[model samples]
Target: MSFLEFSSDAFIAAFFLYCFGFLFYMIAIGGKKWSNRDPEQHVKRWGRVAYIVSTLGLVAHLAFFFTRWIGAGHIPTSNMYEFMTFLGMSIMIAFTVIYSIYRSPLLGMFALPLTIIIVAYASVFPQEVQPLIPALNSIWLKIHVTTAALGEAFFAVGFAAGLMYLLRVVDFKGKTKEARRAQRWVEFTLYVIIVVISFIITVFVFRGMGYEAEFKQMQVNIDSRGQETTTEENVQYTMPPIFKPYNSETISMDSFIGMKQPLLETPYWMDGVNAGRKLNTVVWSIIAGSLLYGLLRLVFRKPLGAVIHPAMEGIDPEDLDEISYRAIAIGFPIFTLGALIFAMIWANIAWSRFWGWDPKEVWALITWLYYSAYLHLRLSRGWQGHRSAWLAVIGFVIVMFTLIGVNLIIAGLHSYAGV
Candidate 1:
């Protein structure tokens, strides 16, 4: 087999290993109550087994990474698929580091799922290695992207830890205003996770069904001399189009559920021709997510919080809070170096300016600032437990929007990654 083919095999292997690791971790933690064996021994044995399996998954993942890099003749961090897989790997690294320090089975329970979700999400994008653009050829690309992803991975662990803390501590039975508010927010957060999973499921389902829709949209391009040129491009959809491109006509569309045409045209004010497609995806994901959430609600017949809160009964809220804080604190400096410092160096080299106010750049700054505030409040202001946990949770949201949402919602200099 070609190296790329072998790399793909390794990637698939890693994915399954991570899934198996997650299963083992669930057994390690959640199965403790029902298992006939002694709880402490069972947890220790199973958790160790889970950790080794996950580490093997990470080793397979590393093999995939280096083999792909060798086959592609560059670092595999250029596109969405590459960067996200790298991020997932980095999360596993962070998880391994934390596990070594804490040896907490509960951390693996949360962190493994987070890694699995991300790796699955990364797989949704096209996997073929493409030639780098001129702006991406610099050494800083590898340095900045890898480091930034690593930092973000730690933040993701912090998010998992924080969310777990919320699940453990938030009182579902209390009648007070604070309790009700916390319960609602926690449920909403869980609902959002379901939504992400729903979107992933929806994409794969439609892809498996060979769904296709196409539209022609007028696009504008700017050259290095700042000259504008116009061209028409064919935009393909893997999912059904609830909305069509702005000022564009259908090239062809495969009907689904007797819907042969788009329900609406995108507003002209959205600027980019791809905006309509992005908006359509967002709407579909929300719809699919809601349906999935409804089904889960029907099955559970209780708030998702109430269902999960029981499983977290033995886990310590204080430990979760500390894990969240440490992960973010460790990540903040690394993020500053990669997302801010190295990025500015790259920007200056690529665009002849240190800061261009690009959407991605602005969001990166916002993320950095938010995390900085988080650390400041955590250390100086003595914010702990619920408040600190919430900040870590929110900070990850900002970090994700900076990483994924910007590429999805708005296209700027970083638009190539969306391809």
Candidate 2:
């Protein structure tokens, strides 16, 4: 087999191993109170086994990373697929270090799933490695992207721990207004998670069905020379189109369950052919997500948070708070180095400017400022527990919008990463 094929095998191995690791962690945490086992001994044995499996999974993931890099003749983090897979691997690394320090099986129980979702999400993007453009071939691009992803991975871990804390501490059954508000927000958070996973599912499902829809959108651009250029771009959709490109002609669209045409046109405000495609993906994901959420609610007859809240028993909220805080604290400076410092240097070299008010750049700065506020509140205002957990969760959301949303919704110099 070719090196790329071998690397794909290794990637598959890592994915399965991570699944096994999560299963072992579930056993460690859930089977502790079983009828015939010693709870402490059970947790000890299974947690150790889980940690080992997860570590091995991480090793496999590293193998995948390096093999792909060696075969492709470049780091495999230049595009969404490769960068997301690397992000998943980085999250596993962060989880291992933190789990080693704390020895918390519950951390594995939650964090492994987070990593799995990420790695799985990576599969939704195109996997073919492509040569970097000359501007992106710089060493600074490598440093900036890798460090930024690693830092974001830590924030992902922090988000996981923070989510677990909320699930642990929130009084789901309480009828008081504060409790009701918390319950709604927590459910909303879980709904958002479901939406992301639903996105992955939606992509793969339509892909498996061999779905196709095509549109040609005319894009007009004016250059610094005051020269006008118009180009017709073909935009493809793997999923059924809920939204078609604005001011575009349908080239071909396969009928899906008798729906022959699109239901809506992309808003004028959301210009660009790629932006329209991305918006369709987002809308499809939310629709699928809502349907799935409704099904789950029907099955459980309770908010999803309440169902998982029981499993969080005996996991101390205070420890989770600490874990969340430490993960973010460790990530903050790394993010500053990658997303700010190195990024600016690369920007100056590439765009001939140290700063630009690009959408991606603005979001990155907003993420930094938000995290800065989180740290300030935690240290100076003595925020902890519920408030801190919420900040950690929201901060990751901001980080994600910076990383993914801007790439999808806005066209900028950074849009090449989505390729």
Candidate 3:
């Protein structure tokens, strides 16, 4: 088999392994009711298992990606599919590193499922190898794409942690009520997670399975009167004209082939021959993402907050606030350097413009500004805890728009990501 084929199998295996690991985590989280008496004991035992499964899952995930990188002769940041894959790996790496330092399994409770969703989303895109675009063929693609992906990954974890923190603080009168609130919080998080995953999947699957979209253009074709036809018309296109879904084992080339005349006039998703694979890949990813998300919710009956210790013990809530702030302090700058500065430099080199108000570019700026505002409020306005956490949550939203939302929703110059 070719390297891409082997790598494909590896990734499929990794996906299933991640699903298995997530199942174990669900078992650990759901089993909390029986362990209330000896919380630490249960935490230690199951937490160890979660850490191990997560670690192995990460290893398998990285191996699949690295094999692709080796086959492609560069880092896997050449397209939207590759970039999402990189982001997924980066999130897991950040979680593992921070987890080791803090010895906090709570982070995993929030981070691991997010990572799985991202990786699964990546699977929906075409994984086949393709040469880089003239504009994208540069060292900057590696620097810009990797930095942006890593920055988003950090913010993604931060977002989950912030949400969990808020849910934990939703005051309740008694242990019983608090426990019920905990379940509600977990359910809400699961719902949000699944929705995001589902949306991506729906977009891809709907588009890939083929949708009827009318393109308004002037075409020069034979007229009904037998003369030359040069008038603007709305053309509707469909796919899988003859082949059924069961026999449709491969991407449809002729469906969207020979469609582009002026290169820039074409939609980004239909940019090239491999574009079909890319689109199909993304759609499938969304489908898988949604399923895995639902599975996560079903398995983990307990709320994620049920698994976390107070951000600290025997200490004031104020200290927990400070620690979270300190983390953002260290992280925000790295995020700025990676998501904004490096991206600008790379975009300038590739696109030949330092700044264009393109959707992706605009979203990146929004992400940067959102975090900047967060830091400013915390330092200058004396904001802390809930306030800062809320900003952290918003910051990731902007980051998500810049990362996934930009490529999928807004049309722009950087829409090379196979939808």
Candidate 4:
């Protein structure tokens, strides 16, 4: 097989191994209640096995990464699939480092599933190798994106630890209405995470099954004189088209929902192919996620929080909070250097300007500012424990938006970086 083909196979193997490791970690954490032997010994034995398996998976993942790099003849951070895979690998590496310091099996229980979800999400994006565009043909592409991904991976660890801290500290069983509401919100958040994972899975499954839809839409564009004009173009979508754009023409039988053009048109600068199809995929993903979440709720017949709370018994909230802070503290400077400083240098070289306030750049700045505030509020304002943990969680959310949302939803100079 070609190196690229081998890399794909290795990645598939690594994914399954990570899932196995996650199962082992879960069993290690939850087996105490059912075991007749010393609980600590059982946990230690199972946790050790899980760690060993995870390390092997990491090795396989590294093999995949390096092979892809060799095959592509460049750092594999140019597009959504490559970047997301790198981010997943970086998260695993960060988790390994933190787990070594803290020796917490509970960390793996939270982190592993997230790692799996990230890798699975990456699979939803196109994986075919493509030649680098003119802008991406620079050494800084590797240096900048790699460091930023690693930094964000550390932030992801903080998010997982922060979530654990919240679950441990929150008085979910308390009789107060506020406590119940908070618990419900936590459960809802868990459902949302599951929903995202389900959406990714659904996309991959349906696409693999050759599901497709096509229609003709009146594509809007600006002429040389800066006047708006419309032309007919064939649009293809990977999902069933439930909705069609208002300016659509020559409709297909697959379009179940149709509407007229809205008063507000898409911005002239926002020139992505098949914007309507992208919106359709998003709508279907949400619907699919909601249905999967509902089925899971029906099967469990209980709040997700109640199911997750039991495994959190031996974890300390304060330690998790501190770890979360430390992760962000370590990551913030790295992120600033790679995402902001390096990005600006690269932009100057490529775009003939230091800053253009592109959507990606703007969101990167926002992420940096959000984390800066997180650190300031924690260190200077004496905000520790719950407040700080919440900030860590929110900081990661901003990181996600900067990484995924800006690239997908907002068309900018960085649009080529997306699939």
Candidate 5:
């Protein structure tokens, strides 16, 4: 088999292994209070098994990375599929390191599922290896992107820890009405995370099944004289179309259903195909995600967090909060150096400009500034516990937007990185 194919196989195997590890970690956490024999001993035994399995999964993931590198003859971070997979791997590595230091299976319980979701999301993208474009043909493509991904991965760990702290500390059983309402909101956020994972899985499954639709839209173009011209174009979008343009003509009768197209139009400069496809994919993901979430609610009869919160009883929120803060403190400088400093150097080398105000560059700066503010607020103003945890969670959201949103939503020099 070709190395790329072998790498794909290894990646799938590692995904299953990680799932098993997560299951074991959950069992470990759940057994802390319920075990008949020494609960601590029971938790320790299962935690050890979980750690070993997760470490093995990491080894397999590393093998996948090296095989892909060898097959592609370059680092595999140039496109959405490879970069997302690399981000998953970085999260796995960060979790491993942090779990070793803290010896907390609770962290793994929160983090491993996120890693799986990221890797599954990567699978939704086309995985075929393509030749690198001129802009990506520098050593900095390896150095800068890899380091930035690592830093973001650490931030992801911080998010996980911060979320755990919030869940643990939120007074779900309190007598006060505000405390109960806050608990509901925290539980609601957990349900949202489940919906997101379900959305990724639904998209992956439907796309794998060759489900697609044709979206017809009015394509506006700038003519040679800079005059606006309109043309109707049919674009194939993955997943069944829930919407169709009102003014455009449909080229394919094969679409199962249709609704009104969105109010916004694709920019004249963007290739309508790329822009339409992205919009269609996003719409279907939301539709499918809502369906899955509804199904989950019907099955469980309560928020998913309500069922899971019992196991979190043994966790110390203060400890989780401290770990979350430490993780961001360590990662912020590394992110600044890699995402900003090295990115500027690479931009100067590749594009002959150190700063172009590209969407990616701007978002990267915003991410850096957000994290800087997070640190300053925490260190100077003594923003600890709930406030610090919230900032850590929000900072990772910005990191994700910098990493994924800029490429997908904004057309810029970073367009080459899209799937």
Candidate 6:
């Protein structure tokens, strides 16, 4: 089989392993019977199992990814799918480091499933070999994509932890049963630990299996034209054939302006004339995967509000609020540097422009504003607990919109993403 096939097989194996890890974690969580007794012993006991499974899953995922990189002759971040995968891996690596330092196995429970979902969604897109354009050939692409993705990955982890903290508290506050209310705080803490893990997974494992396409079009000597003909024939292609994006498909460009038309509509906007096609494949995959996962989860009788669960009441809502604020404090500066400063520097070097109000650029500004407001509300207005938690959640939503939604929805120079 081909290298793509080999890499795909490895990826599939990793996916199954992640699912197994997630399943075991769920089993372990349920086994504790948090409602009946002190869950500390059970959490400690199962936390160990969760960590082992998470470690194993991470190892397997890395193996598959590294193998694909060696097979493909470049870093996987060349396309949207690869970027997500890399992002997922980077997030997991960071989480592993944090977990090792903090010994937070509860974090793993929440993180692993998110990663699994992201990867599984990414798997739906096609994985194939595609050449990079001259602009993307720079080392800066490596630095920019990696740093930016890594920063986002960490923030996502923070979000998961924040969500967990809130969920635990909310459950305790809401539940009317007297028996359930007594041990509400401890159960909530366990759930917070799980949320921490889940967010980490969303960034690292799930995003790891994303897809991308690479394409190039060259003038071919068709029909032995001793006399060249102006009649145009256009061809269309896709990476993972499953990425059925456009209905009208390909049409011959009337001129340079005509060429820009398709580029405008698609998800990717790269350097070269035809570069965006491959990028679009990756963008489309991300959208498709994200939507598919949401739909599937909804279909499976999962409650949207319950997405983050096992609420921790004893941890103190104020403490949970503090954790989220601190996390954003750490993440915001890094995000600014990576997503703005670094991105700007790279754009100047590669594209000959220092700054443009491209959709991506504009969204970055919006994200900055969103976070700024969050900080303002927390500090000036004393936004705490659910209020701050809600802001933190909203801030991440803005971040997501900037990172993924902008690429897909808006049109601009950054359209190379092939949204």
**How well does candidate 6 match the true structure, expressed as C-alpha RMSD?**
10.5
- Tens digit of lDDT per residue, candidate 3, span 1-419? 86667677877776676677666665565565567567566766877888887888778778878888888887778787888877888888777756676665555766777887888778667777777778777887777777667666666767766665665564422468765665565456555666667756565655677653334444455767889955544433243222112111222233334542212222333533233333443444556666776576468654434434343232244533544554456566777777678878877887777787888777777777877788789889988776776677667767776777678655677777753
Q: TM-score: which is higher, 4 or 5?
A: 4
Clashing pairs in 2: none
Cα shift from native, residue 38, model 3 (Å): 3.3
Q: Which ranges in model 3 have alpha carbons more than 4 Å from their true place?
A: 172-191, 200-327
Candidate 1: segments with Cα more than 4 A from true spot: 218-231
TM-score of each: 0.95, 0.95, 0.70, 0.93, 0.91, 0.65
Q: Which is superior by lDDT, 2 or 6?
A: 2
Backbone clashes under 3 angstroms, per model: 0, 0, 7, 0, 0, 38
Candidate 5 local lDDT, 157-273, one digit each (tens): 999999888878776667698877867767767756766677687676766777655556776779899999988767775655554443454465333434333434444454545
TM-score of 4: 0.93
lDDT per residue as tens, model 1, 87-156 = 9999999998877877888888889988988999999999989999999999999999989999999999
Of 1 and 6, the candidate ranking higher by TM-score: 1
lDDT of 6 by residue, 306-330 (tens): 4435433234555555556766776
Between candidates 3 and 4, which one is better according to lDDT? 4
Q: lDDT of candidate 3?
A: 0.64
Scored by CA lDDT, what does every candidate get? 0.91, 0.91, 0.64, 0.84, 0.82, 0.60
Task: Give the residue spans of candidate 5 off by over 4 A.
Answer: 175-177, 223-226, 231-233, 245-247, 253-277
CA lDDT of 384 in candidate 1? 94
Instruction: State the lDDT of candidate 2 residue by residue for 1-419, as single tens digits.
Output: 88899899999999999999999999988888782867889999999999999899999999999999999998898888998899999899889877877789899888898889989999988899899888788889789989998889889989999999999999999999999999999999999999998998888899999999999998788999999999999999898888998888899999999999999989888766677888888889899999999999999999999999988998888999999999999899999999999999999998899899988899999999999999999999999999999999999999888888787667888888887
Q: Which portions of model 4 show Cα errors greater than 4 Å?
A: 221-228, 250-273
Could you tell me how far off, in angstroms, the CA of residue 81 lies in candidate 5 after the best superposition?
Answer: 0.3
lDDT of 6 at 294: 57
**Between candidates 3 and 5, the TM-score winner:** 5
